[model samples]
Target: MTAPVAFPVVTISDDLALATACARWRTCPAIALDTEFERVRTFWPKLALIQLCDGEYVALIDPLTISNWTPFAELLRDPNVVKVMHAAGEDLEAFLGGCGEVPAPLFDTQTALALIGKGVSLGYGAAVQLYFGITLAKDMARTDWLMRPLSDDQLRYAVADVTYLLPIWQDCAQALQQRQLADWHREDSEFAARRLQQQEPAEFLYRKLKAAFVLRGQQLAVARELCAWRETEARNHNIPRGHLLKDESLLLVAQKMPRNWPALSVLETLHPRALRVHGQAILNAVERGLNCPQAQWPAPVRRLLDVPNGKAAQDAMVAAVAAFASTRGIPAELVFSRRVLENLLLAIVDGQPYPPPMWQGWRRAAVQSALASELTSFGIALPDWW
Candidate 1:
C-alpha cells in the first residue's frame, strides 16, 4: 500500500518574508494556492489571507500586513507555474483586486473532476472527500476571515486548503493525461481565467439584470444607462449596487421613465432612502439614455422559444446534436450546452457573431467541426469563435 502525501504549514505575516518565499518558489512547475476573503456588505472583496503550497511546503501569507507584493505579483503572472485551486472564481477576484495581478496557467481541480465524470459542482470539502477518501474538517463556512490575529483553528483551516490541492491535482491530471482528456481541463481553466480577468464595460452589465429582459427600445436603454451609473457609483463608494439602488426599483424607474423627482416619488416599491440618496443621479441617467441615439441601444434579445412552433425546431436540433455526440461516445452536454446552441441560433437570426465559450483548445478540435456541420442542417452556420 502507498503512503498518503502530507505537507508542513508555515505562516508569513511580514511582507519581506513573503516576497522572499514567492521568489524562492518561482522556479516550481506547479503550486497549489487558495485565498481567504470577506465580501459581506462590500463591492470589492476584502482579502485576508493567501495560502500557497508547492507539494512539500505550505505558507500562509497575511494579506493585511503585506503591502509590497511586486515579487508575489510576478510569481502569479509567470506562465511556467500552474496555480491549482478548487472553485477559484472568487480567489481569482481577490488576487485581481488585492494583488493587482491575475494568476494564470491554472489547474482548477473542480473543473478537472467534472470533466472526468466526478460531479458538476464540488465544494472544497466535497472534493477532498471524493479525491482522498478523507472527509475534511468541519465546514468553516462562516469564518470571519477579516478578523485580526486569526485563531489557531482558523489558521489550521486556511492551511488545510492548499495541503491537499497539489496531490489532488496530480492525481486528476494523471488520469486526464492517460485518458487524453487534458484538453477538456485546459479549455475549462482558460475559460474560467478569461472570465475572471476580463474587464468588460459597465454598460454591458445591464444584460445580467433579469428585469431588463422584459424591456425593449428606450426602456432597455434607460435600464442600461442606470446600470452603468449604479456600477460606477458603487465602485467609487466601495458599496454594493443594491445599496445604491435595488434592481427592482431600477427597472421600475426605467419603465416609468420618470421625468423628475416628482414623478420618481410615486414608485410604490422604491424605498424612500434610495429616492433621497440617488434620485438626481437616476434622473440624469434616464435623461442621457432617453437622448441616446438609436444606434447606441443594444440589440433586443431574440428568444428561440418565442418563434411560432419553435419548440419543435429546438427539440430537433437538440436531438440531432445529442445523437451526434452519442455516436462519438461523449456526453451531449459536454460537447455543447443548450444555452450555447440557442445563442448560436439567435446570432444567426440577427446576423451577429456568436461568442461560444467552449470554442477553443481541445473542445474546439474535438467538437467544433462536427458541431458546425450539424448546425448547418438548421440553416445556421457556426461563428469563428467556435
Candidate 2:
C-alpha cells in the first residue's frame, strides 16, 4: 500500500490572497471541500479552518486570519465546480450560515458510499481505509479549531481529509454507476440539498414532540408559542436552542398550564430568562389553552406505531429486513432497519406499502418481498386501507 499524500497547507492571511487562491482553485473542474468549526459552545459554528483540494493542490483557508469571504462565497456559488464532502451536513450548514450561500453541484462521498450498499453511512476514515488502504489518525477529531497557530499535526490531518476525498469519491461514484445505483445517490444528493435550503430556526420547534399526539389543538398553540420564544431567545443570545429551553421543558410547561410567575418558576427546567422575559406571555398562552373549547382543540395526531396490532407487524418487518440486509451484505439499517421499519409498518397500517418509496432502492427490493409477505400475514396487503 502506498503512503498517504501529505497536503500542502496554504494559510490565507489577506482578502487578496484568498481571492487569488480561490481563483486558482476554481480553475479545476472539481474541488474537494471540508470545514472545521467549533459548535460545542456556540449557536453558530466558529469556522476555524476551511480545506479545499483540486487533485493537484490542497489549501487550508484560516477563517481566523481571513475575515472577508467574498472569494470563498464565489467558489460556493459557482455551478461549474463540484464541491465534494463526506457526511457534510453540519459543514454545509456552517458554510451557508456564514456566507449566506451553499455550494452548488455538491457531491457527498458518504452518501455515494451508502448508495452502493457499502455498509450504511461509512465514516470518511473507514471508507478510506477500506477502499484506499490508508489509516487516518483521529487525534485531531476533537481538536479546538478555534485555536490559532494550529499545530502541524492538526494541519496535516485537515489537509489529509480533503486530499483523499476526491479519489475516494471517484472510486465510489464509479462503483455506484456500474451497479446502477447512481440515480439513488443523485436523488439523495438533491434531497440533501433541498433539506439544507429549507433549514429554518422556527421550523425546529415541531421536531420530535412526544406529546404532540395527546395535546389538544390549543395546547399545541401554546407549545408553538413557547417553542418560538425559545428559538428567538437562543438566536438573540447566540446559544444553543436547548440552552434556552429544552424540548422536554417546553412540553412540560405547555402541559402544566402554569398561570402565574410563581407557578412558572416552580417548573425546574424553565430557564430563568424564559420566566423573566416571557413569563407573562407564557401565562397568556396557558390561559388560552385552558379556555379553548373541546371542538377547538387540535385533533390527536395519529402515529403509525399507535395502530392496532402494529407492534407485531413492525417486529416481523424488522426481522425480514434484517435477514434481507444480511443476505445482501449491507447493514440492516441501510434497508428498513429499526426506525425505518417501524415507520414503514406504521405507514402500512395507515394504508400504504410496507416500505414507502422514500426507502426504495436496489437493496430495498431484497427485503420488499419478505416485508410484503409479513404484512400479508397481518391482514395488511400492499396499498390497502387499515
Candidate 2 backbone collisions, by pair = 217-297, 217-298
Alpha-carbon RMSD to native, per candidate:
2.9, 4.3
Q: How well is each residue in 52-89 modelled by candidate 2, as lDDT tens digits?
A: 88887788887777778888899887878888899988
For each candidate in the order shown, give its overall lDDT on alpha carbons: 0.78, 0.73
Which portions of model 1 miss their true places by more than 4 Å?
A: 1-6, 201-203, 235-237, 268-273, 294-299, 320-331, 350-366, 369-386
Question: Taking the tens digit of each residue's C-alpha lDDT, what string does model 1 give over 1-386?
Answer: 12246667788988789888888888899999999998877887878899999877788889898889888999998999999999998888889889988788889998777667676667888888776677767757478998878988888788788888877888889878886778767878878878766655776667667655677888888988999999888877878888888888888888888978889888765578778878889999999889989988777655776554445546665776687667655567766677766655655554555454445566556555555665666566555544
| Collision pairs in model 1 | none
Worst 10 residues of 1 by lDDT: 350-359
